[model samples]
Target: MSERQKPVLRVAIVGAGPAGIYAADLLLKAERPFQVSIDLFEQLPAPYGLVRYGVAPDHPRIKGIVNALRDVLDGGNIRFFGNVRFGTDITLDDLKRHYNAVIFTTGAIRDAELDIPGIELLGSFGASQFVSWYDGHPDVPRDWPLDHTSAAVIGNGNVALDVARMLAKHAEDLLPTEVPANVYDRLVASPITDVHIFGRRGPIQVRFTPLELRELGELRDVDIILDDADFGVDESDERSIATSKQLLVINRILTEWRSRETGRASRRIHLHFYSRPAEILGSDRVTGLRVERTAPDGEGGAHGTGEFREFPVDAVYRAVGYFGSPLDGVPFDDRRGVIPNRAGRAIDDEDERVHGVYASGWIKRGPVGLIGATKSDAMETVQALLGDQSEWWSPSEPDTDAIPRMLEARGIRYTTVQGWHRLDAHERALGEAQQRERVKVVPREEMVEISDPPATAQPT
Candidate 1:
């Protein structure tokens, strides 16, 4: 941090997700003679996108990154501009007009569509939506229905397992967590007993981790039904594989299931392999789904065996993955399903650097990997932004704290970290009062209402 070393560059980072936060940290660490200031913007009033809204509630240790990131925000060099949205309130021109460079780290905000016939039915929803709903997303429906004897999650990834885990959790188990109070109440009310997770590929290709896979056995009263036929592994996979982590994990769970015969729970959580969802069958609402059986191609893939099976289910969740949104200023590639960039450098249609523009995280790489991956992804973008310091940070106007006024004018209510602290305290108090962990606010209105003061408190 020498005078000659401190580089004076003002950077605007869109989306306060891990990628954006990491990029801001890198810019500050550069410590060039020029001042490196980062203005981080988030569409939501709160920061920490997926870390707050995506990760499963039981995995609080994994979300410790939020506190680590809170340190980055408290560094004073990074100004948080929450409740402000890109592609709406302001355009890329407005940001480039003020800051030295703009980094778009807005992660894939939307989930991939299943595009099946009955997908649009009422009971069918994506796993992302379910996760967001239970995690207390302001945009999602508060009073959702899952009143059924059985549910089916259509995917074999970790996300699908998370959905099943949430559904299977004894109401008493979730009572100790930070899950929204209303979501817990609704989940407790759900009569669901069976949760079947389907995979087009065999267990060897399943994407869930060994620890997460083991968590399936911890459920109370939930019978983990398995078929020996589905456990068949390809012979070629044995030699071509580096390690048998996936098989070992699956076998461990299978072994545990076999050892225990009688004392398990009355509910069930079944893991089905080589079963592809061919169609969703429901009446005015979803009643069940049609599944097609498949056989291994011996090359670590599966081919439909032309046999079909149907299961009666009240709800269905597709947990495939997520994709990026098209920002007004950024060059998006539909083929790649992300913003067009060269090693985090935002590139134009003609394959040239779009000056003063960059991208990182899921929007740059397409939704994959854990929170650790965003650090490297963001470092690349920050390095590129540091390359050209002169093009940015020449302020045409003095700084104005417009966030408060803009929110007032647009009728957009928000929650400051202090306000969030207040809500947090209120929830914790409520949870303690009820002898539970913490009751979370389910709807946006309830959250905003708790964050803001009464109308009488405002100055006339």
Candidate 2:
């Protein structure tokens, strides 16, 4: 048979995030004449993984990437199955039975804890949880103890800046966007003033983009503080930070901070460098953090001196990184903090290919790159699938027609692209009525209900 006459390759991508979407886009546009049918699964009711749930609400330009993705979703070839979790609703056996190849692009969902003794204490929350709460994640618990005057985020990454900026900004500033009503209300009433972002390394080693770093100065009612000590950098360090234009922009901002007059700042985000969180101090709730000062030893590692200091804080957040969730029938690597994969093929501990299985994005690469990076990552996985097409197992001779059957069998409710558009329309109308940007329907049940047809279905 000619390549054109070859059977359609039914591809199941486990995530609807950027990585999965890019992969689907590549397969849809492949010139190889092999028919590729993609089923994109997302645990959330909405698509655009981190863009929707991890990005700060103020960054509307960043969020606009979702529009570009809508074109792909509307192409009518790829199927977007939202609110369908892989581990809970469906199993690996089920995906293999339905599709020829499965790509797990589910990004890291959990944050790395400091693992300190008082970490389990009340006021100590993970940065992921705080970020999710502010980002209006439907699954995040709403009642975070944010009613504090001072909060400390133990990291110097962009996420740390985001959390600090959120705390420093007024609720009215966020009212224009789509933050959850409850979270918005709580933030407006929050007494949080001083937001200290700590870094074990110096400011030169900070991972925030220049654009985000510069945005800190735009906070009208907020103060941006940086000690000259933090800004002090050697020749080698400057060269290292000069690779990206984003880092250059950050350097420019720091260079100009001394000349700018930032007025009317009751709430301020103080950027502190070379300080590491040694311990979180409190009895039942967080009261402060014990920090140790460190200096760069000319090598990559830091040398901590015996000297230490304490900053009185009400809440503490550790914005280190995120990890993938464990799914049934999938072999996970706790050490690497990802699903074990060999060149995109999901492998057991024995290093043998778990046929018909695959992985992509943070779940595959342990959460490092930006949205654009997913394209190449996904392409790599797709190439691997193309290489080993014959080894895949198909439980059904023909199409298992899993979508409709799975929806019926497990009473799984889902939203189509059109349905999502309708909900989008509804949200826009509501936002217009309220004189605000699209007021998000944050409750998962509400989103699911809108996604559902006339029949009443129980919430998941």
Candidate 3:
């Protein structure tokens, strides 16, 4: 066949998150020589991986990104295959045989390990798991333990703030949000009154954004507490804060909170800086957290000052960071918790590029950047893939229809884009009855059943 008449460039993106969707959008818009066909596969029945399952329900601004992603999927140029597990339903070999190239945009899901004494204690928990539970991820249990009256959150990032805020906020205040019914019920009965957030570094070194930091103080029925001593900024810290507007804004917010007198609120979020968790104190369940005082190391880091103090708490949640999990047949760097890749191209042990295989987003680069950063990351990966079109795998039969046929033959009842629309509408309808935005469906079976109903069922 001639170059002009050759088959369309069939690409399989093994993730339906912002990264994968952005990849598809970039590919469709790229000034390529030939036509392309994109297919996005997701493990869940619904699309928008992190937006639907990772972001806190109260963060409507962050969740608004889903609308743009939805526009890309509704453009009628790409196909969405939901409830399709990458390793189990389809293998790397299956993708290589069917598509010209495959891009893995499966972003990080698990929490980075926190090595400390008593980390395995009964009341100790990973922030990612707790976020998943509160966010209504189908993979997590419907119920979460909210028995702790006072909790300690260990981290300096936005996620730590999210964990702390959720723990301290009144559950009824979240009714207008998209929190699932079961999660709301459990949160309503929570005994949490005080949440202490610990950060090892100084205030300027914290990773939370200015907006997220400001929102922490805006929570209803919650008092934002910060020790005046924790706001001590050296010349170097002031210089660093001056260079970045975001850092300056965050510092200002913290300073303002520190200047305020302690309010009489039902719930409290105590923000502590320069305190490193030496150990989680407990026998079986968490009883307290032993922390060490740390001073600036002259550089941007901190060093222990041989001073320690313990805070009484019922539970401990570590929101250090998120780490990517390894795929069944992919090469992953265990130490870094990401796939070993060179500029979006998957690299072998010897650092050689694996032809027709690529990666993007947190899976490509370790979990660091935000949602906006994933778009540029996907662009780089897609550009690299497009540039290497000459070396792409030339499948004998790159039929787009063949994938759905294969999936049907295997008895995997996958969901399509149209099905997702139905599910979305269903949720909206349920929310309307309650005079709220939307109520998320937490169960995987219900999601699939709503999206892809049985043949005997009547259409809505």
Candidate 4:
């Protein structure tokens, strides 16, 4: 308590995902006058949010990003609180008691609605749910009904391709990655033969990154089937492709895929462009997918051409997009599925900034970007926190130990960064026994037990 010492800028960031982690890192490194103290709160026993539960495990290239995130969490400058639900385990008033400000980084996890008939069928599913299931998310169901012989994936993004790839990929090929034992077993038992990915626009208008698009053509024992009509690009399409390197690469890859023979492979993925979902055809479960053929309107989008086609798909997955859920005590914009915010500073219904409250990542701006974009996105929110000093919460008890004691008093057995290491070691040990890189722990109770072992339990 010296007069010369600067006051600590205590911040509590909800959701220890890439966005929240990035915000903490930037705040710690920011050229500010005062020292920064951060506490990261996560809902899962694990961290990494979407990266841990939303990414396809088969893609190892994305795992490298975790190293950077790990560096931040392990830096010892931030407190890591895992397995703590924000609203139930802790609340806004609870956070206000321990920190000067709070930042919500709870990114989108729900699937954007696709308004079409029969979408509520038993066999139709949102791609986010499937992604969660396969990624070993603690909350989703472990068993997936891979009973379908043919399936349809609706969307033009990388997620659509991921759904198609997972459906058609051989489970034997996934042994090297961290696919959960339960998911691996289910995939090994799937009878899926063909998976069709539908896009409303042509190849040039697709939202897929070139790398994800190229991976489709690389699956072993799986042939990519495409129709010549889907690739018939007009002058405008050609110009659009030429203007963007991404489109050119996608065009080249699709051109190569178009020339390939299909029946030679044991499994197949069909790419259908200029097709919009008219209905998910089924009674209790999906039996088919009816799509309306669309044509370019010279405005970069497509319009229905009164032509329709049906594919005999037993399951349908909509990878339309991810949407954010409303937080318990935050101003939310239901239309956009994000917290009402202006430049990362959370706003109220009157559009006035809510002092001491902020949002970042998909919760602030919808789910649209990749992990790299999250860094810059978080910096904006961090700047808002650093730049503004007015109305910051004057916590009565800013002690770091107080919040943990509160959780303990509430009988919440939350996980810590050290606990994460233990759980991680356990998964790696499991993978080692199986001669793989890693095996994820799926069930919530098991993950919690593995990460935060009971006090009387022997050392792991």
Task: List CA RMSD, all candidates.
Answer: 3.1, 2.5, 2.0, 1.8
TM-score of 4: 0.97
Record all residue pairs in model 3 with backbone atoms less than 3 Å apart, i.e. clashing: none
| lDDT agreement of model 2 with the native | 0.81
Q: Give me the runs in candidate 1 sitting further than 4 Å from their true place.
A: 1-7, 240-247, 262-264, 390-395, 398-419, 432-437, 445-457
- Which segments of candidate 3 are over 4 A away from where they belong? 1-6, 453-460
Q: Lowest summed lDDT over 10 consecutive residues: which window, candidate 1? A: 451-460
lDDT agreement of model 4 with the native? 0.89
Worst 10 residues of 4 by lDDT: 451-460
The sequence of per-residue lDDT tens digits that candidate 3 reaches over residues 97-117 is 889999999999999999999
Ranking by TM-score: 4, 3, 2, 1
lDDT of 1 by residue, 259-302 (tens): 67643576888888889999899877888889899888877788
lDDT of 4 by residue, 113-182 (tens): 9999999999999999999999999888789988999999999999998899999999999999999989
Error of 3 at 242 (Å): 2.0
lDDT of 2 by residue, 1-460 (tens): 7856877888888888788888899887866657787888888887888888889889998889988887888889887778888877877777777788788888897997577667877788888988888887889886667789999998877888888888888888887887767888898789988999898887667788887887887876887777776656444567766686666676777778856565467887877888878889999999999988888878755778877999999998898877777778888998767999877789998988898888888889997887767778888888888888788777573463657667667877776666677778877887888787777788898888776633324557
